[model samples]
Target: MQLTIWSALILYFCVFLAGLVDSAAGGGGLISLPAYLFTGLNTHTAIGCNKFSAACGTGFSAMRFFKNGALDWKIAFISAICSFISSFIGIKIAFKINPEVLKTVLIIILPVVAAALLLKKNFGVENRVEEISKAKAFRFAAYTGLAVGFYDGLMGPGTGTIAIIVFSACMKYDLKTASGNAKILNLASNYASLIVAVLNGSVIYRIAIPAAICGIMGNYLGAGLALKKGAAFIRPIMVIVICLLFAKLFYDLFARYFLGG
Candidate 1:
């Protein structure tokens, strides 16, 4: 498809916003994917191009996390490896399973998740990693990567948000650290999905390349903010991302089952 001037602007602007939110919280695809579809791309092409730009943006954030000492290298590496491998398998399973089923489940679960976040005022406020054993943290990280990565491959939204929550709740890292580590796992999964998109010849480089630049800028700024503000900043953004994902999934289910669109 030809990249019209208007389309390019729309893609860049939305992708920049997506990168910012995604870097801080993890549901950037909720914004970017709609923007691509709004620009008249088919679903497959939109997803492919989104992956390309997201991978690029996520890489920068992941590096920033690493440099700033926010990440647990061992946990990040273990999760990345597990997610990278399982994501491939998830992709294969996608062809066989209907993603709508998963969406239905998420719609129900998101509210409880959101309520927990809202009611628990001190949820991710402090870094509690000292309390957890090294072995237990690593185990949780691996399980998070495998389970969430598989979901990412199969359904493809809210991966980072879920990862951050799991890291904080289970591993007891603060929100900032969780967000940083989640970026590493996200980067791995993004690359895995991008490879499949590339192999299918679905990525539109003309659009993805320029959009990726915006993504990088957004990610750089967003990561900086998260680092500076710590959990106070990341927590609200995560809640917003979860709410948006919930709305998106609810709408899809509504459109499919009720509206018949």
Candidate 2:
């Protein structure tokens, strides 16, 4: 789709900010996706275009994390493979069902995720990264990436926050390791979904390029901050972002399902 002068500028800025927020918390799509829809692109095309720029943002973040010594390559490798394959399945699931139902589910689940973070007063206090029996960690990482990756491929929100939380709190990974792994898995999902979008011919390159540049800049700053500040910073932001995103989703659902607008 062709972009107007105003829309192109806004799209670029939106992507850049999305990348920043996404790096900081995880729901960058909360901004970019709706802006795309508001600009008159269909939801499917907006989501596809989102993946295009998100891929670059995520790749940049992952590399930055790696350079800063925040990543664990062994787990990232397994997660990338599993998340990529599962993301394809998520794309298939999207076609098989109406996402309206999923939107409803988000209203409930979003609050729970938010509460989980808000309730925890001091998150990531100590580094308690366990030496997982290689097989078990791989198994858990596989499930986490596979499930979250598929959700990302299908719906396109909250993937990064979920990844960080699961890895750090649930899997007992250090904040650094979790962020590193999250960046890689997020990128993998982007690859899978971008292919899906391309196959379906939904990409809007005019917006994608500008948005991606913005996203890269935003994420670069965010990743650096994450490395320096730790998960405590990310946790609160994730809570607020999910709350806002859910509110928007609910409003969209109301408009679409009831108001017929």
Candidate 3:
């Protein structure tokens, strides 16, 4: 499968954009995967390569967050393991079902989430430091990991955003820390999914390599910006990512129903 130079350029450009947005907010796969498919690869291969690039991007951001002391190791580690295991299971389930059902539901929910964010001006801005028991925090982290990880494997978007929201609302963390934690957990899911894709021979390393390089740079820069700017930077990007996810879902629905693809 030889890719034309134009296709390679387009894929690199798309992955670069996806990485930047995903590092700052989440939902980068919303762009990266579609870009892969646009290159005319089979869905499985596209998904596999998407995981490759996405994982690299997330891993870079996670490291930056860790270096900056934004992560809670206990929460991040537990969630990472759970995300990996659950994502593996989710991928298995996804193979058996029609993803359109999930897409339709997301299309409905994304707007509601965006509206909620818009309505609450200071939603992800400040850390509402509530002293909860260690046991409870662990439980919350585990539950969030399993649920969002499952979603990531099954549908492959918004997992990080969901994790960030859970951290902010449930764990009482600030948006910056929440974003950092989300990046680590999200990497686990991407790794699990990428492993599956590799075993199934779904990844195209030729394309994935270049895209991953672009993704790494984007993640590095985006994470740095997030650390510097805080939620003031991440909030609007998160909203925009949600809206893009909505648009992607809408397009998919139209393709499936209207075009009968």
- Give me the candidate number with maximum TM-score: 1
lDDT of 1 by residue, 212-255 (tens): 99999999999999999988888888889999999888888787
Residue 71 CA error for candidate 2 (Å)?
1.9
Question: lDDT tens digits, residues 1-261, model 2?
Answer: 677888877877888888888886678888888778878899789888888888889889888988988877878878888899999898888878888787898888878877866787656555566755777888888888888888887776788877877888767776666878888888898899899788989987877777888889988988888888877677777777888878877886787668767
Maximum-lDDT candidate: 1
Candidate 3, residues 86-130, lDDT tens digits: the string is 998998998799998988888888898899888988887876645
Q: Give the TM-score of candidate 2.
A: 0.90
TM-scores, all models, native as reference:
0.97, 0.90, 0.94
The true-versus-predicted C-alpha distance at residue 191 of model 2, in Å, is 0.5
- In candidate 1, which residue pairs clash? none
Query: Model 3, residue 53: displacement in angstroms?
Result: 1.2
TM match of model 3 to true structure? 0.94
RMSD, candidate 1, Å = 1.1
